[model samples]
Target: MVSITSTASLANALRKTIVDTQNQMSKAQVEVSTGRVADLGLALGGGTAQDVSLGVRSADLSSITNSNAVIAARLSTTDTSLETIATTAQNFLETLVGAQSGAGSDAQAIQDNAVSGLKSLIGALDTSIGGVYLFGGVSTSTSPIADYFSDPPSASKDALDQAFVSAFGVTQSDDAVGSITQSQMQSYLEGGFSDLFSASGWTTSWSSASDRATSNRISLSQIADTSVSANDSAFRGIAAAYAMVADSGVTKLGSDAYNEVLRTATTTLSSAIGDLTRLRASVGVMQTNVSNANDSLTAQQNALASQIGALENVDPYEASTRLNNLTTQLETSYTLTGKIQQLTLTKYI
Candidate 1:
């Protein structure tokens, strides 16, 4: 052995190298946990811009997920409101059918039931979800139907028209006059109202509005408003006939009068039921669409979570293996450095 005094110096240098290796190992552990190679530019010496861009993209996806959650809640609320309207409309039709067929002594009672049913139906149309009217035209500020007499007599065409116009908006033009049925008019009105708030484009959702594209504006708030002027006109005619039959001058309603009332009621009720059925079908489609959208969103979110994890999360097994290899290399380097220092000519001499 040379017995070199430089052994201490070599040992000191080797110890320093070991300390530096240990520090690097510690830093690697931090990188694995955080899913980021700290000081990528300094350590890896490249890709600074790409790292920054990926960070921004991850943040944006997180924001989109939050927005979708809000939209789903509002859509659920609207769907519930639609179900209520459908049920109420169905009940009203049944009650009207019974009233028309009942005895003469129960005329007032039957009329009262009809008025109550009308009120309930009107109430259903005018109800709102999240402050957005279910039936009112673009304006959620007012009721869709008002000014109807509940007792003794039927309401006027003008009153019905006004209500329809309020509920449907400018879509119920002057030309859509006397030719329309109440059922058609109601459908037109409801459809127009609903159309104003229909879903326009592809987006997760918005509460007040949603735009999947820049140019598309689907209104999810408005109900469809079809022409119900004929139904309205028919009801007016029935009320007039009923008034004649009730008057002292008319001992009884002739077969013609009875057939006309029954015909008008049946026709109006059938049309109304058709309109409601179509609406129900539309709601079913919308519910399915919403459910599909929710499922898709959930799947996307899960996929995104996995992607984020792949990008950022560290595998403990792999990290531990790498750490062990680096430790072994550092130990071997120190051992070799010691052996190099011990080799000398002194012991041979």
Candidate 2:
């Protein structure tokens, strides 16, 4: 009876040791594998807000990337519109040079061509993407150039001029067309307006003649010319060009006046083109810079994510090794505990 009782007690001791070791092994496996020691913070204790903060920061990084993508798209579209405007300006300049092809009435044909170019320019100004006007400043929903087809030209020329002045201040319009020749218009557009209008958030307050006189002067330092001014004289150039074009007696004027008018037209168009090209180029550069910035930000986001993952992701191989070691220790502990229990004096007696 004593022997049996001693053996039973030893077996119980061994069973208890094995159970404790197995539990310890299970916990070690969970820690080594999951990285996070906690399965459910509620059962163990509680969690920190750091995890939530990390998640929020990750979301913010993603939002910034998305915003940058949108800006890049807008810059591309602006470049396209600037190109169209430049092309139209070039065509009108060509017509002016032709004067009169013997195949058609020179004056009427020139006027018609000018009108067509003017319409296209207006269209370009009013162009929109996704309900937002490209040239409408901060008021993206509004058309930059109001349509004039409903009114007769005689009745609406002044109004049209006023509308233009309202859309782009006299200062901006004049600065854009300053002193450049018509033949140079294409180059100006390619180099000037192209740079300006393509900028991601480009905007100007020159929405009226009054504003032009007061505020529409953004410096042209980015375009090669720094000597340009915003004085009343700057605007007179366009007014003069319009007068020359409207005066039906260009053929009657002495060759000198006719030549002067032609020269002035070339100059005015060239300046406008220059401003446009610069605007487009600037926007293009901005887009590239922003894209690079976004890429860097994305890389940072990835790095951060990896760091976070390191704290949470499981390592199965490490977990398995630790679990096996714990199991072996538990089995040995059980065998030792059983042999020690069997050494009771009751069994020996």
Candidate 3:
């Protein structure tokens, strides 16, 4: 038995073939122009799993890179502020040494410079970057140090005033403080002055910042401390030393008493410089670590990008060639479809 085919059925089949060929040509043109598969699911089919895995890894690495950038910026700001404080401390130390050597023997002038240096140190420790206080430890929003020039003076300044009266039975600038024994002054320095730098004293007198350090996530599994607080021993020592010199009672004391205070201040300042230098070195090490991690992440990101491109990206040259072939086929199919539509039963008979 022979099978019979209808002209209408043949025409319908030709029309469907033309539509399918035109769709293929359109998709090929898109691939040629864009240099990427128009549909990943349709293009790669089962091979899309690798692309998905690589994309997830790339996104994770990118997130780590962004975190590293933010940490690096914050550390940079911290380093800068620490550097400024170190420079100021060194200059003030020189001034104290000069005073000790009688290079600028005016006690009042030395006292004034010490006062100014103390103010500068406070300002530096309270420095902020992007509305976040760099020296506030975990308390980013709070200023770390109290303002010494506030209406009633800061608690730290008030403590010094009270200590002066208790030790010498006179106000800071009164002539009676000049008559106090060197032994009494030394006692005050070793006992009372030392207390102001202690952890408890710092809380009561100088700072309200957190004792906890701020930390940042720099990598997939690593966290790093990102800031130093005003309560650091180095900062406390600097403040203490300067506060001694800046005290009105110390300045009004006789030359012997004033020199005693300067000597104590000089020793504390020297220790502070050493501590701050070490801290800056540590910050430098952290910076190097973050930079190295970023470099590694960049390399990984590049490799992942290449892997994704191999899986999903179209080759322009190959796609363009295929597009031209499809275009020719589509033209032929259109001509064939038109001829099929014009077919008649008389012609077929």
Which candidate wins on TM-score?
A: 3
Question: How well does candidate 2 score on lDDT at residue 4?
Answer: 50
- RMSD from true fold, candidate 2: 12.4
Q: State each model's CA lDDT, in order.
A: 0.46, 0.51, 0.84
lDDT of 3 by residue, 82-130 (tens): 8888888899899889888988868778778888888899889888878
Q: Please tell me which predicted candidate would have the highest lDDT against the true structure.
A: 3
Candidate 1's TM-score reads: 0.47
Instruction: State model 3's lDDT.
Output: 0.84
lDDT of 1 by residue, 221-339 (tens): 22222111111222222222222122211112233333343344445555655665565565465545545554654565576566545445566777777778778979897887879
- Between prediction 1 and prediction 3, the one with superior TM-score is 3
Which should have the higher lDDT, number 1 or number 3? Answer: 3
Cα-based lDDT at residue 239, candidate 2: 26
By TM-score, rank the candidates, best first. Answer: 3, 2, 1
Residue range 1-349, candidate 2, lDDT tens digits: 3535565676777787788878778777777756654353433333335555666777877776676666566667766766876787777666666653333336545555655665565566666778856555455565644443335443234433443344334422254324334334334333333222222211221121111211111111111111111112222222223333443233443444445545556576666666656666665766666666677777878987886565455567776787888888887876687577657666667
Clashes of each: 44, 43, 1
In candidate 2, what residue range of length 10 has the lowest lDDT sum?
213-222
